[model samples]
Target: MMELQKASNGIFHDAAVEGGIPPEEEKFLQHKDDGSKRPEFTDFEGKTSFGMSVFNLSNAIMGSGILGLSYAMSNTGIVLFLILLTCIACLSCYSIHLLLRSAGVIGIRAYEQLGLRAFGQPGKILAAIVITLHNIGAMSSYLFIVKYELPLVIQAFLGLTSASEDWFMNGNYLIIIVTICIILPLATMKHLGYLGYTSGFSLSCMVFFLSAVIYKKFNISCPLETYGNHSVSTVTSDDTCTPKYFTVNQETAYTIPILAFAFVCHPEVLPIYTELRNPTKRRMQNIGNVSILGMFTMYFFTAIFGYLTFFGYTEAELLHTYSKVNPLDKLILCVRLAVLVAVTLTVPVVLFPIRRALLQLLFPGKSFHWVRHIAIAVCLLFAVNLLVIFVPNIRDIFGISGATTAPTLIFILPGLFYIRIVPKTQEPMSSRPKIQAACFSALGFIFMIMSLTFIGIDWMSGEMRSLGGH
Candidate 1:
């Protein structure tokens, strides 16, 4: 290990001599504070203030999931959606708090650390695979959204016709596109610390999308029957003889997974925490509260308004509703364009960490060339698979993500690791706090099992059943 470190340092020095850090920070420059303090006090950019941290957290949680939430709500009803959203929030806070506290005490970085801390190398490998798999589904879904939507936004803005898909058919060309899209922004980023500004821009775009939808719905008519109740839309069309609306039972249960995906964002939190202005439990809690509350409001309004507008007519891609609006007001058009831009920005935020983790695993040394090539290859493979093999069903995506990976990453590993590895004194001290942590861990474990069971069963069955057709 020491010899490997010496060799890595030689390469780093040579790179530092050749080129400066991309645009953000100087490449291969070491901070004076790095070795002096603990690894927790490593060279984290001091960019995350209290408000900014919350916003970063909120943006991380509120990506492509928001687009499909109303449909999920349509499957489940208003009251149940609210109930599930609350449950998801509670479960999310539980994991964040427990994990943050564990990190504070034990200095864990990756989820693999949690597993290794509890079990051993086997545990580390298991956690890494599960989390990586979950992220793959998530990253693929985001890439598909960007690939399909971005070209339209570009055409709309530039007033050009849509381009043909001939180029993407070539694997090398597709990889080149995916690689450039991902690497341009990420390669420039010195660390995750500086992502706050990008997240802020994304948050503004999200706010615009929400406000535009609300404005569009401000004057629309609704039946007296539909006014007070939070129910799914029930409209029939000539294309489909039958109109489908959610039965309350299915709607409520369906929100369980939707909310699970919405609030499921722990992978980015730890790295962000290291950059906090003041890394304390209180600071973390404050960030969680403000950020999640903002998200709830944004998601709640979008769900209600989206359901009100499209109702039974909603498609697998909910954004398709924008094109159907008769007037297609300039304001809505601008907002749609903005949303497309924001989502394009959002996909890279998630992709960077996954790519980074893989690089660390494969190269184990600072080979930027190797890292870039791997990133390009993975993104291209993902783009091709999504375009060819996968159907854009949010339920299927959620089920696959939640069932196979979410449980292991969010609940099982955290709970088990905390209980087993982080030893607690049998002595009488702070009983209430201990009890609370134990309870939270227990609930996380239960949710983990449910996610695994539901997702696992769905994958086995291979059916996409919705309230309307199935």
Candidate 2:
């Protein structure tokens, strides 16, 4: 054991040297602040301010997932949607609190590290796999937005007639160019601390999107025209314009998973917590509250206005509902551009956690290495771009990813870690923490099963439709 520890320290020293860890700080990278030999805290320090950390985290939570939320609302109706959204938001905040509390008790700053302290090697690997898969799904969603929306923006800007057949209008080609020119550079960054400005900008763009939805909801008369048909419209009288207050069916089960996806900043939480200046469990929890609350407000308004505007007619992607509106309308066009840019900037933020998870799993004791970092970023972005190009349905990706990974990250893991790490003396099986953990885990399991069931039913139905068409 002693010899193995020394070997791991040696690897850390070498990686730190290559990655530019200051020589004086190199010793700090070999052990914890408590003078323990744990590899978790070696060389990591918090540099992000409270406000900036909130912005980064909120950016992480808010992604292309918001676009599908109106659809989720459509399934659940206005009243149930708000109820579920509020419940999910509260549960998300509570789970994050559990994680931060566990990390505080253990003095660990990384999710995999927390897993390591909790369940040894297997736990670490599980955490890493979950983070990698979840973030990859998230990155794909962002790219999906880029792939679908960028071409429309280009066509609008160029004033291209529908008859025009320009190569530049191709979504696949545009995604490649955008990935190479924009996403690649952002994703290759070695630290999350440097992304604060971009994250803030991304949040601002989302706010613009929310504002646009509200403006159009009131300004545009209903019933809105379907895409490509100005002559025919879904007329909404004042009476019919009011949203359905409550409804439930098989579709309602799917909304839970979509709400889970909307609030999934869990993978990115630990990394941000690590970089937060004056970090403490309480401070980190505050950041989580501010971020989640801000997003909750934005999400609620966006969904309400969007659902009210089109009511029963809201599409899966809220932006698509606007297709019938004059594509050349400057305000609507600006909203699309804002959403595109928001999701574009979000790709790098989501990419950071996946890269960290990969490094923690593959090179456990190593410090940051630019070559490895850039290579991983490039490869991950390439893979996600491919999914965006080929995967025609973002909804399926969102459903599966949210169903499988979000619940684990949000509910199961946090609850499990708290149960494992909190001392038996402090938190016995009958204690509130343990009880909460048990309930949270149970809820997560149930959620996962239901979400998968709904997704399976939807998939089979889709297949039958395709066959029927053939």
Q: Which candidate tops TM-score?
A: 2
Model 2 ranges with Cα > 4 A deviation: 1-43, 225-239, 390-399, 463-470
Clashing pairs in 2: 223-236
Task: Give a tens-digit lDDT track for model 1, residues 146-168.
Answer: 55665555455655545655554
Q: What is the TM-score of each predicted model, taking all chains together?
A: 0.72, 0.86
In candidate 1 the C-alpha lDDT for residue 458 amounts to 53
Q: Count residue pairs with overlapping backbones in model 2.
A: 1
72-117 in candidate 2: lDDT tens per residue? 7877888888898999899989999888777756555678877876
Itemize residue pairs with steric clashes in candidate 1: 21-26, 21-27, 75-251, 76-251
Error of 2 at 137 (Å): 1.0
What are the RMSDs of all candidates, in order? 9.1, 6.2
